[model samples]
Target chain A: MLTVKKASRLFKDGAAGFKNITFTVQKGEIVGILGTSGCGKSTLLRVLSGLDHADSGTIHLNDGSPSGAGVIFQEPRLMPWLSVEDNVLFGFKNPSKYRKQAAHYLSLVGLSEFAGALPRDLSGGMAQRTAIARALASQPSVLLLDEPFSALDAFTKMQLQDLLLDIWQEEKTTMVMVTHDIDEALHVCDRVIVLSGQPGEIAAEFKISQPKPRSRSDLSLATYKEKIFSILEYSNTGLQKYSVR
Target chain B: MKSKLNLIGLGMILPVLLIAIWEAAARLGWIESYLLPAPTVVIESIIEMAQEGTLWAHVSITLYRVGAGFLIGTAAAVFIGAAVGYFKKAEHLLDPILQAFRSIPSLAWVPLFLLWMGIGEPSKVTLIAVGVFFPVYLNIVSGIQGVDRKLIEVGKVYHFNSLQLVRRIILPASLPSFLVGIRSGLGLGWMFVVAAELLGASEGLGYLLVLGQNTSSPELIIASIILFAALGKGTDALLKSIESRSLKWQDNLQNAQ
Candidate 1:
């Protein structure tokens, strides 16, 4: 479980980045932070990953600490000098001790054949998969994904989405993902939190309630999609009060 | 493998053609052989010196000066460059003064070093080290500064301390640039050794150059020049191989082709 209370990390006289945002995520739930470009989605994720500090307010994981969040950025960001397996073990202080775990996660992400290969040798999808394996190998309390599959082709993106759900089913890992893709958010997340406007704040939160193995072509999802599209379009008009859930 | 051999064969064409032309001109007496020896005459002079055993003595001492200076210069550069690169405060304090020193034309340090350390091996080695320092230092600073911030963020998410970040991330990330610096530094070391020995030493390939001038042996002069070229190219090739091996992970234009 994770909680962010009144978190704000704005810049340039509050014209950029997120402000006064608040949210919580339950254990084993996949929550997607949906927003357009420049909505400070990344800024919020940085705060959650502990890479940057919130200018005000607080973020606490289950034990009242901010340490156990693993992040998968939009780019693979793999260490070019390291092999795929070594990149997975990068979070560990003693990598040799976690060799087995690295292999397991590599296999989990379908990258077992790439263990000895450098990041350069991998295709974009494979490289991103390696990054996912890397984050999983660390065994973080919560995994924070900042548009992890946004750069991939549609088929690779869909495959990874399904792979992500499979991992969720097996590991029950809590996740907080920031993404601009509406369908992607709908596909993988248990809950979707829409953020909008300059100095972004939460605009709406929707609980999918749809069971696992939900169909993308399902007419029910189309209704939710249309509703989300209206809220996103409306948010673009001007800064407005956050609508009631 | 065949392509690699073909590339080498392509590279040899110009040098071989030039050498052949030089031999023809000298043998035909189109140029005064005493003033500009034929390539064969240079080779013969080299062989004569080798038979006399003085060739190895000069070559060994020159090799020693370059090797010592390279190690000393590279070590100092790595230490100081890493410091200046990693810490903003150190960069602010140190970089301006270092850049100023770098611009002074390292040859200007010769007289001062000679005055302080005298005509001993120390002066020669120190001069070579000074020559070797700047490129390595500059490359290292840029290399560390250029490490992708995103990768450093990855380290930060893992809660890596400053030392761990530098050791595991910064060092390896900057290694390609560091090696580039080292290759160039070795080149400058050879250059300065010639200057150092030309001004002070009793032996070394540069001394061979001086000996030819004083005794009017154009063959010896050409021979020493040829040896300098051979040794310089040999060392550079060695470093290039190392660079390619270590940077095999790079997904750059070179690897793509």
Candidate 2:
């Protein structure tokens, strides 16, 4: 439900964050923007979420409005002074009316018992889950997540990926996630877009037709994983090494 | 609970021991009684003042002056601090002047204020306000400016207006520093009162100190000193309770231990 055309951004010192990038996301799709460090993936997400403006080109929502997008950063970014429940209801104009909905979302992220706890008291995984609940509380049409699980342990990361899929199925909200992990992108996304180069542009795109609850060890998924790795390696070597086993 | 009581008892041991030593020294003729009054003598002076109703009257007047000057000073400081913090132009215009004033000791202002406003209630109150103003103002400005930029980004993503950002993020984030400012301001307030009353007043604990020296009564001077110490401790304890309650979300100090 979102379209970004020829979007480009530059730093104040004239270095490119991203240049001439173009992409579109369909309704109810889970898209992963995968790249290595310094690939401008987070910057792209910021542009998409309207927190920062693109230096050139345009971004348009199909419905012609920009009000309904929720963003979660790598850090939970919860107001430490506010309790978990109040944080979830932070942006709501009528918090009392949405109290039930906030509780529901918190329960969805398995933080029902932690509603009164401050952000400092929560574990890393629990704080990230609370952030997820907060984003979902607004019931936005689009949710943008920027390396949200990077700091979490592997077990917690897997659990959050599964939780995210469950929420996606239930809410059917479009999600755009930025990640550096290959398996994580393959595990959670419907489509993966790889970005490369100093001034990043979309290097390649892949569609996964795998069904829900896809197993990581599945034989068929290996080929897709291998293909993605070769594409990444080729991009890294400037297409000098094309061999793929 | 028992451990807490034990801790308090441990704290009292040194003070009690010192008082006992002083009393013994005075009674046994180990020290001159005229220079340092015995504990019993100070207690008798306190009782005498209580009976004559002078103790409560002096206390009330001192409390009134401190309360008025502290409230006025703190309110103005917070306002100016917010303004300077939010606007670069205000900072440029006001910070230099504030820095210059801050370098001058609170006692140094006593003479200038007396000359300007005369040795009345006005000069005394003005001196106390000057002492209270600097710490609170500096802390508030630095606190506001130091708020994390990442948090401000969150506000932008949520579409919060400038007013909402200030109320929700800036003020609460700066609260710890603001509270610190208030505590220090109160301490300086007490010091300024004593300096003000040293010259101008006919009442207050400070006036009693000078009166004791003039009349050669060590008991009155010691009693006044004790009152000042008690009042400072009591107010600081009150502020500490407020700091802990308001910043309950901070687990850093507890977790560190």
Candidate 3:
């Protein structure tokens, strides 16, 4: 489990980052942080991932280990010189000890054939899959994803979303993802927390009780999409009373 | 691979053509042989030197100086450049003075080095080392500083310590630049060796140039110049091959070609 209390990380006149945010993620739960651009979604994730320090609050991880969480950035960020398998094992203190697990992780992401190939040889989707394998190989208590699939084409994004769900079903790792894609947030997350405005604060939170293997075009998701759209519109328009009815 | 051979053949065409023209003109007595020797006459002079066994001694000694100087210079550059590149404090402390030293022509050190160390092997080698040092050092510093920040963040997420970060990320990330530095350094090393030999030497190709001048043998001078050209190109080609092999992972236009 992870908990953040009254966390504020602001920059440049105190209006460019997240402010006073409080949230908790339970074990094996998938939580999504959704927002429009410039709403400090990434800043909140950075604070949670401990890449950046919060100016006003504390983040507590259950294990109290600095390596307790693994992060997948928007870009694959693979070491070009490393082979796919070596990249999977890159996070381990002693890579040779976990050498066998690298194969498993690569297979999980369907990159078993590419284990010996350099990152330069891989396509964008393949590279991102290799990144997923790398994060999973660490076997961290919590996985933090910062728009991991945003750079992919629509088909690859949907495939990766399903792949993510499959991994969740198997490993049950706690995940906290930051995304701007409303449909994606609704699809894979157990709960989506919406942040709005400059120096972003939580505007609303929606809990989806739907089980796994839900259809992408389900009527239920469409209704939820409508609500999230209006909420995002309201926040983005900001007090200019315009009828979007 | 076949294309590479063709490329080599393509490069030799102009030089061969020019040599043929000069040889033809010399045979027809179209020019003064004393002023400019024919390519064959230069080749004959080189063969005569080789027959006397003096050519081997000169070539070997010059090779030794260049090799020793290159290694020493590169080792020092790696040490100092890594420190300057990694530590902000080190950069602030050392970079200004190093930059100032860099701007001075390396040849400017020749007279002072002779004065300090005497007109001996030490002075010659040290001058060559100084010439080799700057390119390698500057390249390393820039290479380390230019590493992608996003890659460093990945290391941080894994909780890598400073040393681990450098070993796992920084060193490998900057390797291409390091190789580039050494190639240019080797070039400067070749140039400085000639300067070193020209100033004070009993042997070597540069000494042969001086010998030819004193004896008024235009063929000998031409032969020594040819040897210098061959040696410089040969060493550069060796370094280039090493560079290409190590940097096979790069996604660049050269690889596409």
lDDT of 3 by residue, A102-172 (tens): 99998899999999999999999999999999998888989999999999999999999999999998889
Go through the candidates in order and give each one's C-alpha lDDT: 0.92, 0.87, 0.91
After TM-score superposition, the amount by which residue B167's alpha carbon in candidate 2 deviates from its true location, in angstroms, is 1.1
* Candidate order, lDDT descending: 1, 3, 2
Provide the clash count, candidate 1: 0
lDDT (10s digit) by residue, model 2, range B1-257 = 99999999999999999999999999999989889989999999988999999999888878877878898889999999999997899999999999998898778877788899997888988888888999999899999999888888888888989898898889999998999999999998998889888887999989999999999999999999988889888888999999988988776774354
* Candidate 1: stretches off by over 4 Å: A63-67, A239-245
Highest DockQ: give the candidate number: 3
TM-score of 3: 0.96
Candidate 2 lDDT tens digits, A114-174: 9999999899999999999988887777899999999999999999999999998888879
Candidate 1 residue A63 Cα shift, in angstroms, is 4.7
- How close to the true structure is residue A2 of candidate 3, measured as C-alpha lDDT? 91
TM-score of each: 0.95, 0.95, 0.96
Worst lDDT run of 10 residues, candidate 3 chain B, spans B248-257
Q: Candidate 1: lDDT over CA atoms?
A: 0.92
By DockQ, the better pick of 2 and 3 is 3
